[model samples]
Target: MDLSVTVDDGVALLEMRRPPANHFDEVLIGGIVDAALGLDDDPRCRVIVLASEGRHFCAGADFGGGDFAADHVDAAARLYRRAVRLFEVRTPIVAAVQGTAVGGGLGLACAADFRVAEAGTRFVANFARLGFHQGFGLSVTLPELVGRQKATDMMLTARRVGGEEAYRIGLADRLAEPGRVRETARALALEIAASAPLAVRSMRATLRGDLAGRVRAALDHELAEQRVHWATRDAAEGIAASLARRSPVFTGE
Candidate 1:
């Protein structure tokens, strides 16, 4: 399993246990939802902290040696359910991101109510870099967090930004030292744990009601566009070149 959960003092810490890049396959992504969503029915868990044990917080979708999207219509729907499960978790989540959050990993960060990023952290939505549009509801959530122009600029260029820039753009609510992400995340989770659970759940419900529809719509658009790109020569060439570790010769093939 590439995921683990630890509980302490009414707060649950969900850790992505994959090492190095922590790139997620469908199974690992499903594991994340199961780990966090289970907390909703757990009477002892009052808050959740999403953290990772790796060189990077998360490197996004695993493209190392497999095609995750091949005839994957059902798989995509399951993935969407997992995303909804994360949103439906009643407990507020605080992400403890210490390094890079790329692509859908950025979407995972956006899923949380709060994010504590380390000073050395970097984030990039590299969907455009691969000729894919976007995924994980980020096309909607990014704009919700960082505003239209900033999100547009980032997504359009597939550029990377640092921790301070993340905070300035509201991608991360707070900044911490590299070693302090867990500590700070725990502290914030503890604060949420101390608050009234019913009220917190109500607030979360209200917010989700307001935003889930929009998020779903954006996800549909993103995935539809992304599927089109997947069949394009540029996307295939980019993926192949990326795996080959050589410069891509697109030729708009």
Candidate 2:
């Protein structure tokens, strides 16, 4: 949950330092919200670059590392509360996405204004595969980026989308080469930073238009659905199958 923030040339870089796979929880998500809110008050910061120090940008939640089933309802509620703040930020964000952004991680990427990814990068909306409902404001953000049809397909199929396809579908704004994702993301942030700050913020506000509120409502519904699914035996099997590295045999229970 180590998020480092540095500002230079009107661009604020928020780097998540969770090695290998930057998995997130309530505390980590809250830190991101806090960092973004602080950046909003800085007149010098026009753009934010969200990057991760890891092999994978973010592999969603660490289901195996923690007692996921314990007090999950409370934990999810807290996480989603912070997630809504991500959309409330005034500064534009360009996410440097390497490796995989799965489940909630995909939601995190979509929270940014733009995403830079390499050909090998994978974007996965894997909640259905886990027999769980999608969270992290994805209900609104995903469809907003790639359209409702594409978002529905991704969520329902729970398939992996390569960077090229993601870019083509508008899920990713830029496609970088291997090992250059962060550079490309920073470059994009610099380009945005060059614009008139007031004008950019105004335009972004108008374009986004109550997105944070919409995400807030969506998160509420998503969390409720997740709570219901989490109690099911299917969810148990799905989590077990994923941890065991095998395909889940789901019986509609």
- How accurate locally, in lDDT, is each candidate? 0.81, 0.91
| Model 2 Cα shift for residue 170 (angstroms) | 0.3
Sequence-dependent TM-score of model 2: 0.97
Give candidates' CA RMSD values in order.
2.0, 1.1
| TM-scores of all candidate predictions against the true structure | 0.91, 0.97
Cα displacement (angstroms), candidate 2, residue 219, comes to 0.3
Which tens-of-lDDT digit does each residue in 43-104 have in candidate 2? 88999999999899998887786535466778788788778888889899899999999998
- Model 1 over residues 19-114: C-alpha lDDT tens digits? 888877677777877877788889889989998997889987766543364543345555766675666566788999888899888888888999
Give the clashing residue pairs of candidate 2, or none: none
- Top candidate, metric TM-score: 2
Q: How many residue pairs collide in each prediction?
A: 0, 0
